[model samples]
Target: GVTAITAVSPAISARQEDTAVAVANVVMFGTLAMLAYPYLAHHILAADSHRIGMFLGLAVHDTSQAIGSALTYSNVYSDEVVLKVAAITKLSRNLCLAAVVPWLTYLNVRAETKDDEGKEEELEGKKSAGGKSVLAYVPPFVAGVCAMAVL
Candidate 1:
């Protein structure tokens, strides 16, 4: 997420750092989601062991925290499947990050160059950077994600 924001940081006009900080904000929510889900599961959903594992796996963003919490849950409930589900779900979220690059790059590029479209520059001499190559915005970490996924 830091990498994703860094990839687009150069293009944003207003709230430039906010774009980067948004990633951390999202991760904060992931942590909150992780902490909140267990209570939600027990009191609200009345979840069983498998669902609890899956809920946590889907909710938590940090792997170590998820694994640690899963271990706690496993010990608390005497079920190992909770740990497995958490690991799988966290991995699944990381895998999806691999596929998000192209679209995110496109959005960043679009936001950067929202104006000066379809004009041959009859008025002002300024031009939007709408023609930036998509490849230019792809972060190096995305390659690591691809390699990890491949391996």
Candidate 2:
């Protein structure tokens, strides 16, 4: 989406730094959540076991991170369940991505149109007032790119 936005509107390129920052924050939080999940799982059971920890990690962790979690439980548990859960979870998220990207593209285009209208109004106001025209900070166009990248 971001890429599409950049392709459509070069001005959005200026927001790449903000996009990177937002992505970094999300990844950092997601990693912390992945690491903390095992601890949370431990308290949910009668007795903590490494196998159960691995299960939670494998089942709940992000698709990319599930590999290590699956390997952790490989010798102790069947690989089938881990693979199934990982694939299903990843598949489900992928399906969501497929649907969401186009919807977001529509939304971004709509927003840009509305913003253009608003900017035109603002420019008119400034012209009438004999003041300098000012440009507002518009969000980056990489929403589509970000959506695609997540998938």
Candidate 3:
């Protein structure tokens, strides 16, 4: 998710430093989540397979870490259901990335448009005097993702 955000950062006019900070934060927290979530599910929550899976899926930031935690939990507890549920839940969350990036870009463009006070100027391709389409604001990778989804 952070990687996708960083890829679209240029289209959204995000600062490099901000993207760097975001990557750093995700790496730090994602590692911690990977290490901590299994223990939390097994010991702290004392939850069943379904609940443990849901907890890990929702709590962890990255898909790999979430699945890893689930695998760890399942291996320790000898429950395959936990791994399955966690994979499904985490994948469902991952799908949200397709919508989130464009929505954030739209919001950023809208704010910039408001700041421009109706001036006919380009702001990150959201608007342009050259009459560029709204697609101008979409990052190429996002279009590729949509294409892959269609396929």
Candidate 4:
């Protein structure tokens, strides 16, 4: 999702909304899976062990949510490690989304600047060609990078 959004450059906000929709869809699916899987597993897989049900819930339901849920249930559940790791992994993925959106913004802004310069040059060819090459776009390419590093 992060990769997809970042690649879309200039459409950061729209892409983010798209990502939210996708995540919402996945969350809904996970919710349904959590409810359905336990019943199926209880009847067919392990009638004696409730642990299996819990594990399946974490694996299939809201996997990321389950990890967070597991932290509080560590004393009650023996296999908390797996659930914790999975939750952290999901969080890591979400963190990537933060980066993706900003990068797309940068790209979009840069592209816009480039386009604007091109248009101005087109309309004022006689004036610009004889005077100087524009440095209007340089601030973003060079100064922006420098400022970004300082930040």
**What's the lDDT for all of these models?**
0.63, 0.43, 0.75, 0.45
Number of the top-ranking candidate, with TM-score as the measure: 3
lDDT of 2 by residue, 36-72 (tens): 5534544464323544544554454345555444434
What TM-score would you give candidate 3 relative to the actual structure? 0.77
Question: What clash count goes with each model?
Answer: 0, 5, 0, 0
Name the TM-score of candidate 1.
0.65
Per residue, candidate 4 scores C-alpha lDDT tens digits across 1-151 of 2233333323433565767776676677666654555455445645434454345534553444454444434444454553455455554444444455445554444444445446523425322333432332122333443455457
lDDT of 3 at 121: 41
> Candidate 4's error at 51, in angstroms?
17
C-alpha TM-scores of all predictions: 0.65, 0.47, 0.77, 0.38
Which 10-residue span in candidate 4 carries the lowest summed lDDT?
Answer: 132-141
Q: Compared with the true structure, what per-residue lDDT tens digits does model 1 show for residues 1-151?
A: 3444554454333276687577778577756765666566655546476777877766565666666667767776677887788778777776676667666665665566555674332212233375556666566777887898889
Q: How should the candidates be ordered by lDDT, best one leading?
A: 3, 1, 4, 2
Q: Where does model 2 exceed 4 Å of error? A: 1-14, 42-62, 70-80, 115-151
| Predicted structure with the largest lDDT when compared to the true one | 3
Off by over 4 Å in 1: 1-16, 19-36, 39-47, 114-132
**Candidate 4 overall Cα lDDT vs. reference?**
0.45
Clash count, predicted structure 3? 0
Model 1 weakest lDDT span, ten residues long? 119-128
Clash pairs of candidate 2?
1-144, 1-145, 2-142, 2-144, 2-145
